[model samples]
Target: MTGTETLERPETADKVEHFDVIIVGAGISGIGSAYHLQEQCPDKSFLVLEKFDSFGGTWHMHKYPGVRSDSDLFTFGYRFKPWMSAPIATADEILKYMGEVIDDNDLAPHIRYSHKIEHAAWSSKDKKWTVDVVRLDTGEKRRFTTNFLWMCQGYYNQEQGYTPEWDGMDKYKGQIVHPQTWPEDLDYKGKKVVLIGSGATAATVVPAMADDTEHLTMVQRSPTYFFPGQNANELADLLRAVEVDPMIIHDIVRRVALFQQQEINRRSVEEPEIVKQELLEGVRAFVGPDFDMDKHLTPKYRPWQQRLAFVPDGDLFKCITDGKVSIETDTIECFTETGLKLSSGKEIEADIIITATGFNLSVLGNIPFEVDGKPVNWPETVTYRGMMFTGVPNLLWVFGYFRASWTLRVDLLGDYVCRLLKHMDEMGVKQVTPTIPDSLSDMKVGNWIQEEDFNPNYLVRSMHVMPKAGNHPDWQHTQDYWREKDEIPALDLDTEALVYS
Candidate 1:
């Protein structure tokens, strides 16, 4: 509480709290950032403001059957924490791990739960940010002032999921649901279900509900790439048998996983056909030679273009091989009273329809922001390494990697931000802003992320609201973790890209 103070507002009887730093969200990134701040910047007084009642932003919100991580937990889990569970983990498993972090670090006291941030304003003159938040539990409006802002609210809308409009949706009789806001009362037992979309969400749900449903069908406009493998890590098992330290085992396994991922990503660009064939072969090994790989498994896009879902034990294919599930690759013509009518005139009859389309992408948690009395339009601001933006001072948003485990960047960025904060103190600077120099002002700026680099429906749909990125590596949020791992640590704080005052 060295830099923190509480003052009574003269106008309203409300109290205003001030701190050295204010972090938004209490999810994986937020929790991990707190650990770093405590370990690296112990002198700084900070608070975590979470809108939800508890932790686990995505994991807590998603309650769909068989909801789990599309990526493995080894890379997804924090580097400081050793994940002793399976490679793939359920929502509950992730939440439990996050809970352990909170308890271990005593982060609960630093986190203000049920605090929804409505507006954030930065003052250049004061070199501080005034944030207006509402306590969701009591509807109490609270004002907080901070020297720095750390955004970890994630990239997607938690309340409303993306469900495409189809004709006759209102006319349909069955229950329609999205995985984001999964209804606890959704009773799909013995019901004929048609789940839309071919991404990870569809892959997770179809196999989990197949046994309980009368008949389950997966309807996708196009196929998506999936890597089906056994859930266990053989190296971890071997290391554990020899009585190796859990922390050391975690470190070794994490590096190995990252190396393998780098190779795959490199090949996906350098030799996409080879990588594509390897992925297809992984799926073919489970579905047998007779299965229609061309029609039901192969995607039109190359490997690594979109997210590659990891299917544990080939569970989805197992459901397909057992004839418990069916796949239809066609455009949805419209919804019938009973089910959906396809462009090929194939009608899928169902009692329930799951629009596992995806989530709605959010820019800076979709919170209205004002900087020095000017409204900040996200689309107009060019990014600085995807963490900081032009004209924005003393703010860092945790926008993670798309090709690799998101938490990989979280760990990397956590270290970088901590170091940056320490560097600012050494320079005796109260405000630091990223500005495009006169020489680089003419640099070509594009959408926050390049569609050609990585395009998912959720991201493509909200490109208009996302921040802009420059063509240069330093000016954009390079999704490549391999490059950023080395580049970020070596970034010169005194460079022309950042202006410190």
Candidate 2:
């Protein structure tokens, strides 16, 4: 078959099959769960359903220029697989690595592409889930039953990125683009560019565009915390020396890297005044003292209140110093015929306007789940061990945090979930769920996420829901790996969970 043609799988076509476990996403988290589940429960049947045609989730969806990982390969990559490439990985290389992971594990046979999960309903009587799905190619509807449901659908749907309505966007003559849905063929070389938003994407794109664009301006409503990307050459060499022993090498490198990162973070917190002064001094040394450091670099919130934008090898700072890129810290009032009109009544002209705003965090596509016809409200529900939702029996959700590599956290969670499943099987328990007692009162927990951070249009229309940080000790706080292994490994797998007679 040619590259563009879809090969027909007549043997596995248009049929519904049941499994012991059903994983909803084919992304890194979902793939990690599938890998662990297959290893733990080789005797049981399991399947992974991917909404898109390919394996890589976000990497496959985003194809803009300078697309790459924000974190270093040592920490961002899979523990089992040694990142043999440079310290930082390009998007194409990352996608290729993801493909290799899926193929090397022989996971292709168990995956069904173009299958989007629509909704899932649980039956208390049977202690199983009946999931409804749609086949994107043939427009066929189907259903499958599974004993356990794992939602690794990730935090955002690529179909929608956060795009706010600008007052006069329609009147603008220049081409408007959202980085998430970047057009592949659109040419930008030698064009005057204006990139909106001060997040990671903007940080990566501004410097990349400066290489060819006539001029580039990064417009931000507020400042985002920036940090120099500390991808070390020594770490890569060390990993190469111990490549044969992946686990030991991963542990060693991860520990050292985490230590360095935490030390930097600690200094920022413990010696704020000194660190701030040092940072300001560095900025002045890079740019002139006349440069507006407060307007461009000073963040209103504390460091890591959100994620800090990483600049690989000081590329962003270099671009600013070279006068190739400029930062404009003003509220965008509206879109003009030629470019953007700021609140200060000043106009910035551009041939192309790219919106790199952010993303909408969706916990399992905000799908309304029903167990025995009783609807489950997820935001009101507490997260159990930060993996499973309260009252959602036999269901597990995997999510990463702003502090660590998404895959690393999810990998640990996946292993813990598999262990839980194994313990359940040994105990002959059929279903498990967290029961919140009335005696305990709920309180606001972490400020990792806030309502203002999310786009109302996207959240209300799409599948976007935030899980509550649990009120109890078991449910509250995300303490890194050691604490997680202790709590989750000893969790009451044999609790008052249901068992078939």
Candidate 3:
């Protein structure tokens, strides 16, 4: 059988479908990538394979109460699409927006739902990828071949969230749940709940379940930074009042928000004290001066070290002030029959415990990848701007920025990948891989990301499995959108580092 031809067997439910490009996942990154490919590389045949039954990856997976976007929709939404709602949006609203994108672009025809990729094998001789897949809805097996593989499946494992085992966890009779897999039938009304986490998920769930629960207490080992403000955008409102184009309003508001974020990030590095004080003072304003900011709200690290979760209109603080939610900054000692005992000897009684700790990091959707019969070892390979990796040909992974809205990099990488594909066509090459030059072979290498730069628990826990970064800019994923915005567009695709065959 020819490499590009579709093969069918009457005896078995197996077939090999070929495409110019095959994108993994149907989430925000994958959908945005698909739109760019269609618009820029009009002649290239492509397909998007989503393991889930529908679109909206994280939004669809997370169903807990008060689930919402931590980043403002103006910046979080795609640049081509206008998010004409409040700055903060619910999962349903985000899904509706994504649905509109699919409908407007006619992308549904190109997407294959419920197709979970099993193994992806690269053929050096054939200069293509042969993918093994299983239909989740059926027991049918399928095969697909593509000239290029675009991994947009996301960075975390969706099957299970990270819930640390504590002493006597099994002895506790109360129900335990993770926000990633929130059960629809979960009734929290009149229940004494203790949520364990200090991240965005905990902040979201506390206010959402506060009123209904007998009492909700947020137990965090350490405090996290938060930015609380009104959900509405004044600039967008002003533009709407004057009847400006919705598209123009979106662009203007997004740019302004980005600019503001850049300023704060800069201060976090250059003048951390000022930024720290500003953040603390903001919290004091919300919780009132009488509240103990240092004991309950202040974080050990500087601002922007971890994500400063956005709390719309200070709702979390409102919950605290209204006596519906309480914050306990201490470590969990052990679980009791009725509740949890803290390291400080304080016991919290609860009927339900929600672990919003975090998620387990995954590499390439935890798919076993083989290159020319040998398994791909990600840690041994070096990343090319955190997209392409060494020894991996005709493949790219979309790993977005931690500090900025994840969609921003999705849009940026979308353009870069399309251009690279076109350049390959021009060069008469079917394979391309990032190669570490001989001169830099002995240079000091480090973890996937620098701890000092950005160290959330998910990335910290999975650093061992991640690809290494080098001292050079070409071999590094800086995670700086401001610098990368200019650097990526100006990148030389024909450099020697990118070996073409």
What do the candidate models score in CA lDDT, each in turn? 0.91, 0.74, 0.91
Q: Which pairs clash (backbone N, Cα, C closer than 3 Å) in model 2?
A: 365-463
Worst lDDT run of 10 residues, candidate 1, spans 1-10
Better model by lDDT: candidate 2 vs candidate 3: 3
* Total clashing pairs for each candidate: 0, 1, 0
Count of clashing pairs, candidate 2:
1
The TM-scores, one per candidate, come to 0.97, 0.88, 0.97
Best candidate, lDDT? 3
Of 1 and 3, which scores higher on lDDT? 3
Query: How does model 1 fare in lDDT?
Result: 0.91
Candidate 3 residue-wise lDDT, 106-170, digit = tens:
99999999999878889999999998888889968888999999999999999999999999999
Per-model RMSD to reference = 4.1, 6.3, 3.7
In model 3, the runs with Cα more than 4 Å from the true position are 1-13
Model 3 superposed RMSD (Cα): 3.7
